[model samples]
Target: MNPIIELRHISKTYYLGKLDVPVLHDVSLSIMPGEFVAIMGHSGSGKSTLLNILGLLDKPSGGEYLLAGKEVSRLSDDELAGLRNKFMGFVFQQFNLLPRMTARENVILPLVYADNKTNAPDELTLLERVGLKERVNHKPNELSGGQQQRVAIARALINNPLLILADEPTGNLDTKSTAEIIGILKELNNAGITIVMVTHEPDLTEAADRTITVKDGVIVSDVSSGKQRTLAAAGSDGSMAAGFLTHNLLKLQRVRDYFQQAMRSLISNKTRSFLSILGVLIGVTSLIAMMALGQGAQEEVKKNISSLGSNLLFIHPAAGHQGGVALEAGAVTQISLQDVDAIRERVPGVARVTPYASGRGQVVYNGKNWNTRIDGTSADFPVIRDARVTEGRFFTDAEATSRAKVAVIGKTVQRELFGDRDPVGEFIKIKRIDFQVIGVLPAKGSSGWRDEDDKIIIPVNTAMYRLLGKENVDTVDVQVTDYNAMDDVSDRINKLFAVM
Candidate 1:
């Protein structure tokens, strides 16, 4: 039979700043399968470190640890955790049960991490085994020291692990509770579970099959039972396979048992859980509220820019930098209607194309006159510029092609010339050319550069022939389908212009 735990010259060192503090030094130990072993030592004798290494909770600095014939250091963190959950269980002197969980809930908590996909062990049944059936629903604080330790024992056995590591199992108990704990451990050993306990008391070691005394990180004495009690195992090939099948089936019983335990704890301590959840809710709510406000502000800015035709790549002449300074974009015009049509046909991300021209003009309506900028644009102007008609409707493509003397007046123009009177369907004189005001545009306040609202829009043909008397288009504003590829498409458009 292979040894359950085999350690050869295991050593551990922890660093406190620059100083190297050694715990275990050249410590060699072996414990057979199914034997109760007690590791005894004084305080600061590195007993806890040895227990940690044995339990796979701490790694040895220099040594080989073979757990059931497989080296431990080779396993990854998750794999080690799985193996610990599957094969080994722990019991502490503090009886570390969650204060909110009942006795049965605490006992069955390990099955959650055990990955018992189905058919987990019955929590109530395990509590019964530890003589806590009557106190199964009791919480940790409600139980006495001995009953709490019993609950701990039930928990250790819940996973059906091959070995148990009890760190000072009865240290905190009174005399009667300590005796009770020791007896329960003895009963478990008699029933064939291997238990390794850490203690300094002689009375505790009396129950163990073997006792190993350590002083200053080195073993001073080792007394064994000399093959007295061997592990109760299914040695026969058929029986061992059957035993494993049974364990696996039992593992299937408690599926996600840990989550259920957590839910029960939360339900049990409703007030604390509610407070915690409420704090998180308020934090997330405030975050969302602030984010919504920020998003609204961003949209307002985008709306303003869209009013000036956002998502637009102006295909006008690129002004040469004068005195190491680049002039305002689209300030000078060399592009034409032919360039706008070419881009709409060839460019991939282009959504729409608008060939536009702009010039200064004076307009009069109702005997009131105002000086404003005149813009002649295509039918897609309102869509691309995100400008909504406040009254009447924008000029249609047919009307623009027919060179109709129709115009869309802005808020500032309406305020100056119409002055609270309806401007739509009124006749306005631009450059002494009488044009009918077909619609009124929503307000766009002035920026530091210019007054955006003091402008009028008309058909390109009408502006060229009847108003400004220009034949060629100055700017071609192209809208795109995707903003991510905006720069690439603009560069491509530039390359096409270079070829032209």
Candidate 2:
């Protein structure tokens, strides 16, 4: 019969700063498929290190280790983790149960990282076998030392592992608890699960089928029971393919179990969880806000450059201050239609000019009322501002000169007042005055907190005289004929405005 595990000339050494500490020297061993082996040693012996290497938890400095006929050193870290989860189970002396989780949750925790759970044993049955059925919902603090160790044993059996590794599992328990743990381990061995235990107590070896004694980093004696049977004599197969199934099942159950465990922990410890979550949120929010601000600044600059049109310059009144406090823009000086016309006629390199004003008003059409922004501009506004009319023609220059009540609406305004219906040739009331919708502006998306496509445009003369009742316009837009003459044109326009 082939051995389940084999190690040839394994050596382990630890380097502490500049000194070399040799733990194990040229050790070799073999463990069969159904043997309950006990490794005994003194305080300074290397029994624990050997057990760790045998369990695949540690690597030897120089050795060839084989587990079920497969080389161990050639596996990647992820593959090793999957193999460990599927094949071997570990039990420590401290009974490492998550304090916040119940007994059942602790027993089923191994399934969270398992690669193949189709052959997983029933969790409730395992718990009941360990005499923890009634106390399955209790936490670790509510159970005694023996009961907690029983839960750990049940956890070890959850995956139906081929090998169980126990490192001083009953070291902290009393005499009675130790007896009970030993009896349970013997029962498991009789049921054909290979177990390897590292202990210093000599009486525990009587329950095991084999005992190996180590002293000062070397094995002194290896004694086995005379009644031990090989795999062939026991009528069992030791091949890996015949033993375990590799089908993956219950993948989503792993995630759900993790989420439920997290929620339970958070609900149990309210203050710590709140502080932890708040800290994470603040950190993530700050990171995202910084990234957004940087990207938004770049995007905004690009959008503004594109929207300005070729060789275009915008002129606006400078803000004023009173009592050392800043005042609203256009508070001190406002541009008028006369100023716009003067710039257009006298300014050199000027290609096009448009007067602009803006205000907010309530718009009503067919019993639906919405409040929106209103902009007043000339016919050349679309050319200088790079705005396109999608539905109909913009108001003509003659319409602006005659102060005709005509309007063009943006996409958002169109949607709010008229759903899918055409708005051209329809009349809407703005500030209790009727205006004909002559065109629809294309969508412009949003800018910061404001929707750019939620406004209406009308003629500058009509807005200043009939709708808004203002004498002066808000700003002026100028487009130059040549790109290189922009600076000179801006200087001349500033000089002309200063003297006017």
Candidate 3:
């Protein structure tokens, strides 16, 4: 019969800041199937390190390890973890039961990590077999030290592991609890479950079918009971080593199990869980709000830039200076209506040209009155400035040539004077002069600290000669037919104005 575990010339060395500390040296051992082996050693004897290597928990620095006729070092880390979960069961001295789970929940914990749990034994029956039937609902803290160890044994049996590795299982239990745990382990061994226990106490070795003693990282003695069963005799029906060589790959089911486990832990610790959830919510909300604010600001800047009109340029007279002292803007040279007409006729790639002038005025309609900005331009103002006339129509070229008393009201002026009523064709008095309202402009919202819709529109000739009484316009707005011809048109306009 082949040995279930084989180790030949195993060595372990740990590095501590350039210092090599040797734990095991040239250790060789083998254990057949269905054997309860006890490894005994003193403190710092390297016995625990050997047990760790045997359980596949740690790798040896030298030599080979074979478990169930397969090389251990050939498998990847994930495959090794799957193999450990499927075939090896561990019992720690501290019980290692999740403090938040009941005994039954802790017993079924290994099934959560197992890729295939179709053949897993019933956790309740395992608990009953370990004499914890009445304490299955109790938590680790609620149970006695011996009862906790019994729960750990039940957990080890949940996956029906091929080998059980106990690391000082009774190290913390009282004398009575130790006896109970040892008896339960002997019963498990007798029932054909292979168990290898590591203990420093000599009395615990009596319960094992074989005892192996180690001193100074080397085996000093190995004594076995003649009644130990081999692999063929123990698994006569061939169930003991069935599927032992197969590798279990990770599956998606484990993700759900992990989330369930996390939710259980959170439910168990309410205050800490609430605080953690609150902190995450606050951080996520702050990130979303900052992103939204930045996006909104970016969109607003684009809107304002587009509102200024596309492919358009403004021609303003430079400020005058005398004796190195700067004077007010447009004090030296003023843009007149003739200059606007010249640009429209002579400038190449000129799509539209309009003279623009602005002033403050008090507009009175019926009993309502509002002080607002007044702008005067030609009919091409809407097309050049991208201002849509939502109602009525702009003043025609003939109206501006004749200096007619016709005006277009913006949304704010309409709201203050008309109040939901149509102001089209109604006469409003601007600076006490009766002007007919011809149209209404669409809402333009706010730009900077001023409302773009809080204004009125009139013909340039009427504004300069009739309303505001100015000699020349404030600026000239020019729109180019194509973007590429802007530089040449600008040069020609500069040359024309430079000569003028």
Mark the regions of model 2 whose C-alpha exceeds 4 Å error after superposition.
229-253, 288-500
| Model 1 agreement with the true structure over 299-366: per-residue lDDT tens digits | 88877776777667766666766788887654443566677778899888999988878899889876
Runs in model 1 with CA error above 4 Å? 14-22, 113-133, 225-259, 276-284, 306-364, 367-408, 419-451, 456-500
- What TM-score do all the candidates reach, one by one? 0.64, 0.56, 0.67
Task: Give the poorly placed runs of model 3, Cα more than 4 Å off.
Answer: 1-67, 70-81, 99-101, 112-119, 122-125, 190-192, 196-355, 366-368, 378-380, 383-386, 396-405, 432-434, 460-466, 469-500
| Best by the TM-score measure | 3
Error of 1 at 30 (Å): 1.1
lDDT of 1 at 487: 98
Once model 1 is optimally superposed onto the true structure by TM-score, how far is the C-alpha of residue 387 displaced, in angstroms? 8.0
Which candidate order results from sorting by TM-score in descending order? 3, 1, 2
Q: Per-residue lDDT of 1-500 in model 3, one digit per residue for the tens?
A: 66778898999999999999999999999887788999999999998999999888889999888786677855667667777888889999999999889999999998888877888989999999988889889999999999999999999988888789999999999999999999998888777778999999998998888899999999999998666454323443334334543544556798889899999999999999999999999999999999999999999998888777878878998899999999988899878888888889987889999888889999999889999999989988888888879999988999989999999999999999999998899999999999999999988899879999999999989999998989889988889988888888889999999888
Q: Give the per-residue lDDT of model 2 (tens digit) for 170-198.
A: 99899999999999998887888889999
Instruction: Give the winner by TM-score: 1 or 2.
Output: 1
Which pairs of residues clash in candidate 3, taking residues 3 or more apart in a chain or in different chains? Answer: none
Cα-based lDDT at residue 237, candidate 2: 39
Worst 10 residues of 3 by lDDT: 232-241
Residue 409 local lDDT, model 2: 98
Instruction: Score candidate 2 by lDDT.
Output: 0.86
